[model samples]
Target: MSHRRPLPRGLRLTVTDEGPGFPPEFLPRAVDRFARAEASRTSEGAGLGLAFVQAVALAHGGTAHAENTEHGGAVTLDLPC
Candidate 1:
């Protein structure tokens, strides 16, 4: 995992990890609750991580995204400081 540093004042910070990225089509819907592109009753989660992130960002007047990392994959969050 890695993080951007020394954000300007009024900016919130976030970190990202390298892993299997989700599909591009799913990007638009990633912030929705229970909105898993790979949703499965047999899986562990109830599809809430991205949604939670989105909620936090929104609450802080910002946004979130999931994307393919140059090296792998990552999730980013931007929020008001």
Candidate 2:
């Protein structure tokens, strides 16, 4: 799912997926480089996706956040309009 809304000084874009959410312990460090939820390191990612998102958001003077809903996970990027 995707959603967009206007803020006072920016726009918020939220993307949600229905896959299993990130592990509970991984939530705090979700934006860190090479931070993977899978302990075995067998997942398909190098764990840089969220980190890249965060970096891009910061470079644009914005912010990124990750959270879990009842059914899945959501990432929200708030960027300057």
Candidate 3:
């Protein structure tokens, strides 16, 4: 599911998925370059997805966040209009 809210100067968008979610310890580093969750080490990619997202957000003067939910995970991006 997803939710979006208007901000004073931008918007707050959140997306949630039904999965195992992210590891508590890995949440903080999820946006780091080359960082990957232990469970997905052998999956694919160089783990730059979140890093790239964060970079884009920063470029737009916004921010990105990731966290584990009770059923899965959530990623939020706050961006300016």
Summarize candidate 2's per-residue lDDT along 2-79 as a digit string, tens digits: 999999999999999999987888889998998888869765888899999999999999999888988798999999
Task: Return the TM-score for each candidate structure.
Answer: 0.75, 0.90, 0.87
Q: Please list the residue runs of candidate 2 whose C-alpha ends up more than 4 Å from where it truly belongs after superposition.
A: none
TM-score attained by model 2: 0.90
TM-score of 3: 0.87
The true-versus-predicted C-alpha distance at residue 76 of model 2, in Å, is 0.7
Give candidate 1's error at residue 35 in angstroms.
1.4
Per-candidate Cα RMSD to the true structure, in Å, reads 2.3, 1.2, 1.6
Query: Judged by lDDT relative to the true structure, which candidate is superior, 1 or 3?
Result: 3
Clashing pairs in 3: none
The order by descending TM-score is 2, 3, 1
* lDDT of model 2, residue 68: 94
Q: What is the C-alpha lDDT profile of model 3 across 1-79, one tens digit per residue?
A: 9999999999999889999998889999998998888954667788898899899999999999899878799989999
CA deviation > 4 Å runs, candidate 3: none
